[model samples]
Target: MQRRQFVIALTGLFAAHRIAEAAVNPTDPIKIEKLVLSDAEWKKRLAPEAYQVLRHEGTERAGTSPLNAEKRKGYFACAGCDLPLFLSETKYESGTGWPSFYNFIPGRMETKTDFKLILPRTEYHCARCEGHQGHVFDDGPKPTGKRYCNNGVALKFVPA
Candidate 1:
């Protein structure tokens, strides 16, 4: 009985820690000031596909983004707020049919837990606009063992 109580207490502490970490403050260095917009305004400013991906957290079909074949030297910015998120240098072929980057521009993203698939996953969004970009996974190339699997419709490529 004592062992079971200890296990439960430990689990509660871990859950509390996760909750605290997810509650990022606006004043945190990693959190950019937010840009709040009405649904109508967002609809007006973004394309139909971008609106769905950025605002509604919808995923674009894999292998459908021209960015999958993008090879030019440039940066990927959020489709919603044009906030530069990833550099062209960080991109790599993950064979996941989505735009994959190993790293992002510093202080440009915020992460939270997602349970949409009935399991916990780290979901990242643009720090400036809170636009849903994609999920980050542990499998990635050297330098940063993190793959930022982004939805193409949520990004805009800007040539550097």
Candidate 2:
């Protein structure tokens, strides 16, 4: 093969590999559902932050979550559905205010592009009920190379 043609072929192969690695399933449509809570019941159930992020798609300030320093064997549940989504073993200190996990229990969460801050970010919600949780990122401890950074307000940690 000609040198120039060989380089072009190699470049195409590399690009294909990267694309395959990055491909993820499209999130299901956000389905609107009636709240399963009475007004007083929801108010009593969630904190202010939890209400905003889980019910209203709000983001919390970075580096402010106590979960960043949390070190315990447990499962993290969606504050919305109470569904288990992450293991404490996957958690990491991403210094991003929320709880950062390297991976999730597959198919437990979904994503959409968030333009709330004038920038595009991949925002994820609980797959069970489509409750807004938080964003995922490329910046994370390796192996999976995914930072499933979740809003501390959107999760409730349960000790094992």
Top TM-score model = 1
Question: Which residue runs of candidate 1 sit more than 4 Å off their true CA positions?
Answer: 1-31
Give a tens-digit lDDT track for model 2, residues 1-160: 9986676567556544432332231122323222243345455668888877877788889887777787898778777656567888899887667789999876677789989899999998876546688888898888999998888878877777
Q: Number of the top candidate by lDDT?
A: 1
Model 1, residue 38: displacement in angstroms? 0.5
lDDT of 1 at 101: 98
Backbone clashes, each candidate = 0, 1
Candidate 2 has an lDDT of 0.72
- The clash tally of candidate 2 reads 1
lDDT of 1: 0.83
